[model samples]
Target: MIIAVGSQSKIKVTAVKNALCQLGVKADIEAVKAHSAIAEQPFNQETRQGAINRALHTAQLVPRAAFTLAIESGLYWRMDAWLDIALVVARFPDGTCVEVESEAIVFPSSAVEEVQRRGVHTWTAGQVLQEWGQVQSHNDPHLSLVGKSRADFIQDAVVKLFQTLQARHLLSV
Candidate 1:
């Protein structure tokens, strides 16, 4: 199976490979830059549209592939703070589509505001957290607060998301 990954970011490439490995999927995967944009604010529609845009673009570029994978993520204030939510959209050759979404624990608002204030155009959840000086806060009570690095958190979430997708039979190798 040939799978076209919609982005060329290191984190996304690693996440996709790790997800495929964990799911026992055997396929040839390649990364192609489908869109040129960064996250500014969080919204459900924007996230979905980003993924859809990438998926459609990649599909045009890699027409022979079994399916195209697109991932769009953003941080939103849920409950009281920003939470990382990534939604994956898959487009098959026959025009069918499937979507999967994964979310992390809410992030503190101070962190989000600080990052936004810095005018940083390219920042991930991990970078945003680091800017807030919470990298070493071992006592902060939150979900998955066992000193888990942001990278690890995203990896776990992607793996779980792959599981969720497979259970739904969205894609198969």
Candidate 2:
């Protein structure tokens, strides 16, 4: 099977690989450059839309692939605090789509402020966290704040979506 992933991020790619492994499937996976079409720090709806957009865009890029996967991370405000959310989307060649999401984690106020006030990207905020020794990687801060690795979070979402497709008999193998 040929699978196309929307982002070049190692975390996202590894998550897909891990999820597929859990399902006992193997495939040739490729990463394609795809845009989220939303702000660097997107809100609830924007985050979901971004994930969908990336999946659709990657599907268009590799139309022959059995599946296209997209993962998007964003921030949302709730109860006077910012939180982190992740959305995963999968698109099949037959025009079927599935989506799953990660639980929200309360984000660091300082990082959120920097993104909102200085117009910095979430990645930049992550970098700041790295400098403070709060985060060990550039792509994930949830590791420190929520005690959950980014790969695990992404894998959970992908696994949920894949299970849904399997339960519905929408996916073969």
The CA lDDT at 26 in model 2 is: 70
Residues 26-139 of candidate 2: C-alpha lDDT, one tens digit per residue: 778899998878877676688888888999899989988888988988777878888777888888877777887878788788876766775644445566677778888857
TM-score of 1: 0.73
Lowest lDDT block of 10, candidate 2: 118-127
- What C-alpha RMSD separates each model from the true structure? 4.3, 2.2
- TM-score per candidate, chains pooled: 0.73, 0.86
Residues 1-173 of candidate 1 have per-residue lDDT tens digits of 89898988776777788888877888888899997254544454767777888888999999998888887776655676667677777788887778776646666667667667765465444465555566553222233344445445555666776676678786564
Candidate 1 error regions (>4 Å): 36-44, 115-129, 136-146, 168-170
Model 1: lowest-lDDT 10 consecutive positions: 137-146
Error of 2 at 14 (Å): 1.1
Each model's C-alpha lDDT?
0.69, 0.81
Model 2 Cα shift for residue 97 (angstroms): 2.5
